[model samples]
Target: MKHPVTPDGRYFAVRCRLWRMVNPDLDEAERSKLTKRLMVARRAVRDAKAARDPEAEAVAHRAVDVAKRALGERGPVWWKDGSPDLNRRIAKNTPYADWYAQVTRSRHGGS
Candidate 1:
């Protein structure tokens, strides 16, 4: 849970890639509910893959997508600032590149 977040807080870095943060505007209960749905859908995807059921996997993937979108992690940008969505982009390739470099240098103890 201790991932580096972009300065604007719009995304978090994981494995050096950016993933959009969930909508902070969502009420606590709504966000929790959507998060639960996402967990369930992700589990379904795992099950489908283990069972070698391609059709079921596809369905589960769609469920995951829907849940993510509802949580504002996908689809339309949640922030109204007109900034481009950087979901899934490598941090080093984004405007966050300099910040990311600084963070890595600090964490790894470099000048």
Candidate 2:
């Protein structure tokens, strides 16, 4: 769950994208809380890197990961009974190959 070192702007962009994906009707307070946590995590990452401390960097990475998970990224899907997560694996390599192809075709009109 360690994210590679990147520009602070990149982290902000990610946070923005995740925020956009959240339910629009979600409680404002809850959304603000998650956004704050994400900012803290990103800062930890930046600070740890500046200090050039590997252990602190790892911890910071974990913090970023934890924040992302809480924000419904890179962890369990928030939606109940949603389709199984295939991660980044190719559909043809998993049992959902056929189903994946069918879904893609329907969604993208087979491009």
Residue pairs in candidate 1 whose N, alpha carbon or C atoms collide under 3 angstroms: none
- Tens digits of per-residue lDDT, candidate 2, 10-94, equal 1211211211133333488987898798889889889989999889989989988887777665576555666554444554555
lDDT of 1 by residue, 1-111 (tens): 588888888999888899999999999999999999999999999999999999999999999999999999999999998999999999999999999998888878998
Model 1 weakest 10-residue run by lDDT: 1-10
TM-score of 1: 0.95
RMSD of each: 0.9, 9.7
Best by TM-score: 1
The parts of candidate 2 lying over 4 Å away from their true place are: 1-20, 23-26, 86-111
Per-prediction tally of clashes? 0, 0
- TM-score, cand. 2 vs. native: 0.53
